[model samples]
Target: MSAATLVGSEAPLAQTHDVALVDLDGVAYQGHLPIDHAASSLGAARDGGMRLVFVTNNASREPEDVAAQLSGLDIPTSPDEVMTAAQACAALLATRLEPGAKVLVVGGKGLVTAVERAGFVVVRSADDAPDAVAQGFSPDLGWGDLAEAAYAVAGGAWHVASNRDLSLPTARGFAPGNGSLVAAVVSATGVEPDSAGKPSPTMYRMAVDRLDARRPLVIGDRLDTDLAGARSGGYPGLHVLTGVSSARDAVLAPPGLRPSYLGADLRALLEPHPAPQRADGGWWRCGDRAARVVGDGLEVDRQGPQGIDVVRAACAAAWAAADAGSGPAPQGVADLSA
Candidate 1:
């Protein structure tokens, strides 16, 4: 996890996760689940509406793979809707590097392939590190290989890290990520590499430019990468609890690290003007909102606009419905509600 500095430490005047009403296709989307709603929002925006691009800092996977992963989570997304730091490196070098310039890699195939596809020739540097070590979740790394990379970086090879996340979570537990490996190189070489992940304007510029999107909104799970990245890019970020950062992080979050909006998942804003009403009957009344047993599936217009309360009630409903063995929430609420 990124240590908390003053929020907006990098960009003092940038808006943190301050959220507000935004319209798409003549309807209002609560904008809490930005990542979940990204694809549909972009599509709807274009058809006489608006657009958004999901700039993700997680660099282990390419754009297509990331989109596929999100899809499995029931997030409606497209390859064009996702941009990873791996892809950013490719886009960054595209304009700066000479065609097919020799480059050394320090991450995984995602980063390597991104560079190669960008027309750079990736060569193992004279520095002895295994070129690059793919470290994330369960990294198959050896001390000798890391020692080699340390030597190579000390020897003057340019080092590129796919991301700077300290750990990635899995079914098992937290594990070291590329950021830890890059630390070895930094320690040996006294050279800080240009991080290609979140909070790096280089990565955000790539995704924003790719979609030619203006006034775009960013969405993701981690406050360190996603919210900070949005701050760097002068955009708003929506934080969701399904992934990395948790409710505790939001409450204790330093200023810059807080999200503009928060949601249980992408489904929070699928409907417009969701209101929770308890009637005398066993059935309650919720209109212009999606429902499930998990959270109140119930909408409270009064949840504080900022921080995790931003969507706590929604989460409560979803969690409740889930315990009741509810099937997927009502479908056909217009795919854009995510």
Candidate 2:
């Protein structure tokens, strides 16, 4: 659907969607710690009859380990409720390579287990004469691992990467993720690996199939990964502010990256969404908030009862202005919280 045609619903989102495909890093936990309200809100959503599935691009940890982490955080989950990019990458590789084909693993035990489960033999070095190379993220990975992947790819082994997320959030701060490591191999071999994570539609499709969801909502913090993947997979997405992207980033998002719903956090699933309607005098109204385009600039005419409403109105107005080519690109949202 076009961004201009998007509208909010009077019914609570929890009642509308059968399942929620939730991203892990930014939405549920920011590294090793769980985000505020994440556990409770998700539990409430589950109580309200909405199923929750944790979808992560991080391929370093196995599904069972990820489930254990979430369970320890008070959000009980099973391995079946979690989907990783490594699983998706392995599935993709299985379709191209013969059963029991030797595949060089360039990442962690997670990727190795995934490839092996898909009936491929996992090898460590290019000297193994592997038929393909699969890479993911692992803290234990080093220059030696990248060199092996590069050699394999340079020698014409089909290469696959779990995801291309350049940076990962950690308790200390941002650190290089799988994408940065993948770039090392790319620079050495001058060949790009086929990605099987977010923005590829492969992972989303797998999640949908696994959940058997008739109507699923994609929830995440990153626009480039989660929202982009939802859009590519023809699913509705909700962008939450509890993680990476801010209100300013959401308002300025391009057509493909814009989310269908914007919320402060997962609590939005229980609340009725206020539609932004075009108002008199070229204004847009959402709940008690209003915004307007004034000669290549955006002006906030009224702040809503809640800060999120104001953000919603501003996003609608800015996206409308962008579609009509009547205003400059939305720089930021005034009076909106991050």
Candidate 3:
């Protein structure tokens, strides 16, 4: 079984976990701009002996491109150290089809290269009579590409999507990701493609195997995909507040989406995680803070310089309440931004 709630670590996570399957888009950089403290904290963790794998759901670019971008952002990554959903998706299709199978590619160079590397014949349209349609995210994709995918799927071709993430983080904001494109095909043909990206354990398992990591931790910003993938992959995950999900989201997450630890940013890797403990009056306490779910609300003890401990305690109390058949009041969680 997965850990029931947030877990404490005696040492920094970089020391505790042998490898980190780190998410790229939201956790590391938001649309090319690196998150604050990400590069330095990651460097510190690497210096402390933890191996890092850049596991990403974005299938728009190749691993080399991803590595270059990360290196440019001061993350100092290599192609071999990066894994893309396009690669995983191609590998998945390879298992389902024979070598040199005709696959209609619907993304960019990343997906095309991945399919080709998997020993498949990459085609462009449904007219190719492709055996499979490999769909991923690409900004240049248009109605013509989606139409071809729909036609292929409508003609009994197997549909494979890199991921099902509904949103992609960008410098401006969240944009429609691969999932949105997949949904269009699904809506047109009423055929849901098999997804091989996050929320599925395949990507995480692949990273674990490739890195030969005995103790792997998942680090991400989204609770629905990244954290959910960690739980399904049987790895502990840290939910950071750098991207999509909020602290209140953590407090309200169900078991499948709940994270093992929570932090404000990448710096969490260098600090010890304080476990929340049960205190008097049914409150959950962490560090110098305490919180308990009241009737449709939460009574939080606002101690500590930063309210991380209080946030931790609040999450614990909320989770405890949820496990017992009810969740903490929305009003209490409404402003849990810290």
The candidate maximizing lDDT is: 3
Predicted model with the maximum TM-score: 3
- Sorted by TM-score, highest first, which candidate order results? 3, 2, 1
What is the per-residue lDDT of model 2 for residues 1-338, given as tens digits with 9 covering 90 to 100?
Answer: 54423468789899999999999988988888988888999999999899988999988789999999999998999999999999999999988998989999988888888999999999988998889999999999988989999999999999899999999888888899899999999999999889998877788889899879999999999998999998888899999998777887877777888899988988888888888999999888887888777877778865335488878888888888888877645544454673
Look at candidate 3 and tell me the lDDT of residue 103.
Answer: 97
Report residue 68 deviation for candidate 3 (angstroms): 0.5
Cα deviation of 132 in candidate 1 (Å)? 11
What's the lDDT of the predicted structure labeled candidate 2? 0.86
True-vs-predicted CA distance for residue 51, candidate 1, Å: 5.4
lDDT of 3 by residue, 98-120 (tens): 99899999999998999999999
The whole-model lDDT of each prediction reads 0.50, 0.86, 0.90
In candidate 3, which residue ranges exceed 4 Å CA deviation? 304-306
Determine the backbone clash count of candidate 3. 0
Error of 2 at 234 (Å): 0.5
* Candidate 3 C-alpha error for residue 144, in Å: 0.6
Clashing residue pairs found in predicted model 3: none
Deviation in Å, model 1, residue 259 alpha carbon: 1.7
